[model samples]
Target: PQQPFASSTPQSSNPFGTSSQSTTFSNNSTLNSSNFSNTINCNPTNTMNYNPTNMNPSSNFTTNTFNTFTVNYEDPFLLKDITFEKVEKKTAPFSRIVPKPIFSEATMKPLLNLTYRPPRVTQKKKIYTEPSIEEARHLKEIENLVIGFEGKGRIQYIDKISGTELTTSNIEDKITFLKNEVVVSDPPGIGLNKRARVYVEGIFAFSKSQGDFIVGKAEKYPLKAIQERFVYSLKEDPYKKFVDYNYETGLYVYEVNHF
Candidate 1:
């Protein structure tokens, strides 16, 4: 009768059962002599199945009646009884190898076709600097004039009509002669004149070939026709041998002739 071991345990304020209440026992709670003797007899009867090493000090399954212990329990990690063994290394050595290159069926046909002709390579003809329009026109004119000379000898003219007759050697002299010889409302105005002196070796030059022949650059002509007769003169005579004719001294001296 020690209050029957206070059948209900103490309670706490914890709602989730994380903490427990303190335990209390009466100082005079002692077992009776008869009950103690009976407990000793019962303990010996269960000694065959009892294990002292495996005894749990505070387990819920204990041989007692007064101490009504409740299991304050929880399952932490839900563990399994798993067993592990040691791992061993491989017995033999391992290696890796790389294979050589091989031509596939799809690429072979196209490659063979590419090599059949041995690859003919031709370079396009190129002119680095193109000629200007003006230069090209002048070149065409020269070509046409040269073509005109293919058949017959070019008609010729000269400034000197025979050794007995002598006319002006320059454009000014030619203009004065034309004014006195031919009558007109007005004389033909001098279009342009340029002084170009070329020495003669064989024939003389023509009056028109002097400076008055303005259309083209200077060239010599000799013995040109005047309608019916061949006026044996030297005007634009290309073959004429030019000489410096001193007008003041009235003397003619030979000089080197060039184109």
Candidate 2:
């Protein structure tokens, strides 16, 4: 060869030679094409290492850093799905109650006076005679009335015209006679802006033993005062009963309804 290539074989006692072993030793540490490209891409400082002979010498050789940041061959186990359960609510017994209808200005119209009256002869002779009898019977009736309402209380007397209290001495005789007279009413008035004319004939306590209440301490024989817890009962009409006189208004009020 023209100027034979350098070899490791001795050359006329010259020290330098280019044998295969010597040639390979210098190239072994040099990067292949693929290694040079990867180095250049990953580090700008190593760009000088990207020589033409260094890029992918064989297709089978792949760098470890090649797919680390990409999804091209990522592990399938990293993908996951989460699930959760839904709960239903339970209701309590008697949770719903029907409300009763409320009667008020907003819900219903105001009610008018509801009175019951029987036909009457405005000018009957008996009416005139009865008033006279009533006046004649006053003193006697007063006594009976006192006896009838005995121990009722002070307020019970306020409703009457005479305003006499039987407890006093002056009205003693009048009070006694009233108790004996009967109670009767010819014309009944049961409504607003009206009046009831009552004629009480006899006094009767529903339970006679009930009278024992007024006789309290009578056994003591102290000749002392006694108080009777009296419960007066009377029917105002065929339909309803009025138990007693209103201690306040003195107006006849309905009794406790049995129904």
Candidate 3:
């Protein structure tokens, strides 16, 4: 083998020497046995030039490049794409105004004569007539037979026609004489000219009697007498007409002339 050509420059023991030949040896270049006979040339401008021989045109290779950039602006600011629009303002409708009415003076009229006339008073002649003899006798008989009890449960009535002494404990027995067409005299000393009816005191007990035949058969009996015609006060002058049996207590008063 011919002795390998040696360079005139000093040989360095460092594999990565600062020589141009060592700087040109990069990953992009290939080393082969045929390239050993060729001499390499390097430029001082740090650029590389390579010519490969018998390289396949269909060889697969890939290269990628990336570029990065940075921008700076004020924080919390809106972008240029953002826009604002104009808005329309709304107003309320106006109210209608009303006019006041005018007043006119009224006319006055004359007063008319409104005389008030008094009504005529008529006076009738008074005619006084005496009572008939039969009427006088009947009135005397009623006055004599108007019997009243002196105390409770005591009969003080006397027969006017027969002149017989009558005594009974039953109230029905005392009122039996007045059942037949008897006339009640007006209360004495009243002088009011008002017709009188017989009022019996404590006679309402017979209204609830179921055994008293005389009280049950009497016309217009003392049914509801205690409720309808009961006299509340003995102080009232109207009770003078009442034939009170219990004159001491004077509790109940009932009208019994209809019976």
Best by TM-score: 3
**Runs off by more than 4 Å, candidate 1:** 1-77, 80-121, 125-259
- Give the per-residue lDDT digits (tens) of candidate 2, residues 185-249: 21222111012223232233222444422222233322222211232234425433454443223
- The residue pairs found clashing in candidate 3 are none
**Candidate order by decreasing lDDT:** 3, 2, 1
Worst 10 residues of 2 by lDDT: 185-194
Q: Please give the ranking of all candidate structures by TM-score, highest first, separated by commas.
A: 3, 2, 1
Error of 2 at 84 (Å): 0.4
Candidate 2 accuracy as lDDT: 0.31
Can you tell me which runs of candidate 3 are displaced by over 4 Å? 1-140, 153-248
What value does the lDDT take at residue 146 in candidate 3? Answer: 33
User: RMSD to the native, candidate 2?
Assistant: 20.3
lDDT of 2 at 174: 27
* Candidate 1 accuracy as lDDT: 0.29
Expressed as tens digits, the lDDT of each residue in 1-259 for candidate 1 is: 4553322345554354334454443333453322322211212223345456567666566467887856534534434445578899756534324454476544544534544565579642221111323343434222111101111111112211122111112222332112112111222221211111222112222344344312222233332232112112232335444444322222223211211
Q: Backbone collision count in every prediction?
A: 26, 33, 0
lDDT of 1 at 40: 15
Q: Estimate TM-scores for all models.
A: 0.12, 0.14, 0.15
